[model samples]
Target: MDCIHLTGIRSYGYTGYLPEEQILGQWFEVDVKLWLDLSSSGETDAIEDTVDYRSIISLVQDSVKTSKFALVERLTASIADSILALSDRVTQVQVILSKPAAPIPDFSGKISIDIIKKR
Candidate 1:
């Protein structure tokens, strides 16, 4: 299998258990890996023969930015499911979501969740 990696996808979303987090919103970063066979695309060099990354980008943005969820797990699942639904070529997907400004009092690093889904 081949992988198409998209990293540092940032969006503003309302997702958290805390009321303030929902009200104020936060910046979420996403990294996605789409696994598929790329032989046809490599041979043909045709857009239709491969995954359209722009469409994937749009789908991710819409999935993350348009709705509110209480858990990053849900957000990640939504992304994975949407990607799987959008393309039959995708045999597997990995989504990583990070919240840089997580509500933890002392932590400086981001809080993130990673999920892998297979078709």
Candidate 2:
């Protein structure tokens, strides 16, 4: 299978266990790898032949920016499910979500979750 990779999608969202986190939304980064067969799209060179990534971006944006969750695990699952709903051509999906500004004391790097789902 072929894949489409989207990385470094940044959005502001209120999703955390802490009260301050919910009150003051933080920046989140999302990465996705969508697996599908691109042979037809490669041959035809038509938009209709392949997944529309702009639409996928819209879905991710809405999911991240418009919803609140206590865990990025749930958020990641939601993103994978939503992407799967886009087309049957997608056989599998992987989502990586990160909170770079996580409120952990003395943390130097991003805190993140990664999940993979198959249809």
Candidate 3:
């Protein structure tokens, strides 16, 4: 299957296990890979024959920005599910949700959840 990849999508969201995180929010990076057949689109060179990546990005941004979640796992699952809902052509999806500045004292970088789903 052909795939479209969206990487390092940055958004400010409220998704964490702490009070301050919920109130103030933080920056999150999302990476998504969507699997679909692109033969028709490639042959026809028609936008309608393939998934619209800009729309997908908008969906992800809206879903993450306006919502709050306590677990990256749930957030990833939600993203996958939402993407799946958008089109039947999407046979599989992988989502990575990363928090670059976690609240942990010892942590210097990011923590993330990665999940793959197939329909």
Candidate 4:
């Protein structure tokens, strides 16, 4: 299988357990890996034969922005489901969601979740 990776996609959205987080929103980063067959695309050299990444990005952005989730695990699973629904070519996916500025008392960098799904 061929894989397409979209890493470090940044977006601002409301996703957290705190009230302030839901009201003020926060920045989130995501990385996605999509697995599919690329033989037709490689042979024909046509974009139509491959998964359209722009659409995938749009789907991710829309999903994160419009929905609110308290846990990154839920968000990650939602993203994986959305991607899987978008194309049958995507046989499996790996999703990562990161919160760089989480309101943790002792954390300085970020917290994130990594999830894998096979359809």
Q: What stretches of model 1 exceed 4 Å from their correct place? A: none
lDDT of 4 by residue, 1-119 (tens): 89999998888889889988888999989999999999999999998899999999998888788878877788889999999999988999999999999998987989989999999
The TM-score values for the models, in the order shown, are 0.97, 0.96, 0.97, 0.96
Residue 113's lDDT within candidate 1 is 94
- TM-score of model 3 (CA atoms): 0.97
Model 2 poorest 10 in a row by lDDT: 66-75
Predicted structure 1, TM vs. truth? 0.97
TM-score sort, best first: 1, 3, 2, 4
Better of 1 and 2 by lDDT: 1
What residue runs in model 2 are displaced by over 4 Å at the alpha carbon? none
| Model 2: pairs clashing at backbone N, Cα or C within 3 Å | none
Clash count, candidate 3: 0
The ten-residue window of minimal lDDT in model 4 covers 63-72
**C-alpha lDDT of candidate 3 relative to the true structure:** 0.90
Model 2 Cα displacement at 96 (Å)? 0.4
